[model samples]
Target: MRLIQIINDIRLKRKLSLIFITVAVLPLLISGIYLTNKLREVMVSNAFEQASDNVERVQKRTAEVINVALDISYQLSNDNRMKSIASRSYDSYNEVIQTYRQYTDIRDYVRLYKEIKAIRLYASNPTMLNNWEFMQPDEQTTKEAWYVSALNKKGLAGWGYIQDERDQKHYLSLVRKINLDDLKNESVLVINVNSDLLNSILSQESFATMIVDDSNNIVAANRPDLYGKNLSAVHAESNMLWQSEGSFDAVMNGKNSKVVIANLNPQNSWNGLRIISIFTISDIVHDANAVIRISAFVVGGCLVIAVLLVYASASLITGRLLRLSKHMSQVGTLSWDSYLDLDGKDEIGQLSRQFNALVHRISQLMFEVEESNQQKQLLLQKQNDIKFKMLASQVNPHFLFNTLESIRMEAHLRGEEDLAQAVWQLSILIRNSLEVGSRQIPLSEELNMVRCYLELHKFRFEDRLQYKMEIDPATEGIEIPPLIIQPLVENSILHGLDRKEDPTLITVRTRLNDHGELFVEIQDDGAGIPPKKMKDLTMRLMDSEEPGNRIGLRNVNDRLQLTYGQGARLSIESEEGRGTCITFCIPKKGVEPVVFSDNR
Candidate 1:
């Protein structure tokens, strides 16, 4: 009752107090949420944009720098400097090698060769580029991917990696091809790039950036260590089987994260992928406590100051309020020292006016608070709207139902009209039961439709199947939600029936309370759900996966909880032969369009 009175009082004064309280409190709350979400998105977008721009810039710069090196290598490949060695002449090859060593080490030209590790030109098509090392005869092998692609590709290009004499890694290889028709074209002009530099081209600065292949496998990560791991894995629950696109909020190491991914084959190249995701932490757990503390401080401080004014300046209150009003004319620009402009002897009057002004400010804040609360409520409603739609679309039972209806219609025109119409009605009922797109549906509609489906199936098998439905008369007018009962009936039919020769019996019951809620119970007799399968199904429902999980029931459960807060749930109770029963406890609100006609 005290809480109710407080709420009533706030509502009464809501308009007056908005400016002072709600203006400050509500922005802080909303801004707190925006900071947690929007800021991370901004940071990630900026980071990737910078990364792509940097890579392009580096590639352009490298192209310019490497032109000189490629020209020199091309000139030498045909010149007497390299061709002398190509003819297996010791003196010529030795002179060329000495000339190479005098200038700089092998690492010097790597920054120029964007994709070559260590390249040596061959006089004729020698089997391997590595075999013609200048000084130290290292791990020179002709069988590398870069070596093969270089000789074959014949352009300004870079392949992946290969280790050198020092067993150091390198990622680029470049080879220039010659016309060879004019002069006795000796060797292929080759200039290999250093691999370490290639890796450094896109290293991590803050959050990691990774490149995924078509298979969802990470080909490269800014961290380098995660280069081969797959990001789509959830304890092997989801694998990167196909290309996926969108932004989703996920949990990473128990921290809230928003991940956005796009299949990027920029320049329309299918050779690689661009996969980007950003993570941000959210702790409303802490925000709630902060709000409580801040609210206490705000309300307590204002009340304390108000009490002080009443006790300290009773007689001069009206004059003080006027003086304060004059001072506030320059809210942001005024000087506090000149606040007491009154020439009267009533110092107490001046103080009283100022105190009253303070009270007025609090009143304005209260009004603003109400406005802010309304805005928050609106925002929540919008978010729930999307959530409801997502849940409804999750498990689409439309296709199966539509096919059933088609079968029924064909049967109806062929002299089995009663049975066909029954099938048609059952299909329509199932279709109606599949919609989870709303938070609240009318209880009347929910019950009537379930009755249609249950009756249809009940009549199909004649005396072989039986059903009992009970509803509390008082709960008839209450509002509930759509499609909350079908899953319970389904579980009973599929699991409880269990192919038993004994007749099948199912029961559905509903009850309600003054607090505005509905309780629905469904009981069936057949083979009961085992404790193990039941537990697994419950767990899977929380995190639905396709094919092996309870796709229908889990999807329904998710929709129920997400749409109607925590009040709705599905409960199952069954044992072998003395059949099974499932119950859906739903709220007495939001039920509507009680029955969907097959007309659509």
Candidate 2:
């Protein structure tokens, strides 16, 4: 409570300042920092995705090159002629030259395919001459690890960096043992894949990329300086590189970097290669940080402008309110002569003008108080006289009801039962017409009054007039305006039976319609109104003009519209010489409430 009082007591200017700081400044700063961090993350993520795609492309191209070499190796391994040439014992150098010239497939492969650098077959047959395509392995060549491994594998192919004996240059080569059919000696086939092809593929990439064999030797690289170097010498996570196959964060070139790795497993080869792409995270988000700096400057400028605007607006408002407050204090002294004189087109100026009008009104009211008191006494005396007259007017209805009762008793005493019954019914109709005027009555009570009215008519018309009621028991207690149905019943007898000698039947039905609304209908099988008269009656019922005479239909329509709105008005359907039906449905909501009463 004390804190609330303190806050309430603060000046408006200071309150606005606090709101600006908490609502605008703090949230702006927090959101700016959050967005900056999110943008940096998005930049890094996009960089990694591009690098991953680069690695995939390099792996695919590298696989294509390596697959070419493997296919060539398999074809040459199964070549019966090459196997025969390598395994057969040659007696002379001319025979060896002629044989090498005849088998021109190896030379055609290295010449026709850009991916194959060289193809060489090392034979252990001493009689075979050391031609460029077919070489006789010496002691040093047979002792090489690749040669020994290929020999130990018996028939499977192996891939590794092996130097061509002719050029003494190292290349990524596929080494396979080709077993002679009937001989114990095995010949080795080497297919050197062009390292330049792999290097060109990586050079076209944006990030630094390289293909490394399982031995950790960089076979090909976009960076020439890193070629042929072990991965451990250049990367810190070299030991763990083989452990992860996809991507990971690491330190490279003394900077934070993301590295993506993809594997290239060639067909029918013992060793597979890994394609690696590395890019620094800082390089990826460098542009994003510059954009954030400019955005921060713009946001700060806006906040400064907002602070100035808020302060200036607060000062202007508080100054006007303080001046108004001082003048309001003088109003306690009842000084109406001096009014507020503030000026402007704003709301405060309008308030000042209204205050002046109020002061003038107060002064005028003071002068009129005595004159109003003098008139009040005269109105009281007149009201008392009117009340006496209204009381006198109610006495006649009671006297008439008493006189009807006396007549009914006299008829009963004289043994005139029919006359007594007629008198009783007449009394009911007269009492309701006089006392229940324009008030709501229960449908059951209204029906009883209607019965009385109809019975009296029956006494006059005899068999010529007949009436029937089809009232749903559930609608007996529903309230409706008095005389709504009785007037229509009376109209039927007057218009139908009076003009014609034929009999007429009137039906009063009360039931719920499909929408659960109360539907009341009075239908008569008598001579209906003509078309012209019917049109005039409908127009008059809908019009707001005061009906000069025969206001029963118009009055009922007005009451229905006034009580239940326009949708509850009556519908009349009549045809000349046939019948007429007058129906009005009260929405179930309107019938549920007892909305009108005559307390008089």
lDDT digits (tens) for residues 1-600 of candidate 1: 664333323422342354335444554565456454544554545544554444444444344434445555545544553444344434455555555565343445544445444555544433223334432222344454444554565443332323444444332333444434334442344454443443454463234445454545554556656654665662122422343655555556666555545554322122334455444444212323444555566556656655564444333344445656666664435233333443333434445456557656766787899999999999999999999999978755767876787788788779887788788777767666566565565666677787787778777667767888787876665555456676667778777665666788888887865655667778877667777876766776667563444437776776778767676766656554466666666665533224435892
lDDT (Cα atoms) of all candidates against the true structure: 0.54, 0.82
Q: What does candidate 2's lDDT look like per residue over 431-468, in tens digits?
A: 77777765678888899988998899988898888999
Q: Can you give the TM-score per candidate against the true fold? A: 0.29, 0.43
Prediction RMSDs, each to the true structure:
28.1, 24.8
Off by over 4 Å in 2: 1-39, 238-241, 282-600
**Number of the predicted model whose TM-score against the real structure is largest:** 2
Instruction: Give stretches of model 1 more than 4 Å off.
Output: 1-80, 91-119, 122-140, 154-158, 165-168, 175-192, 195-201, 210-221, 227-600
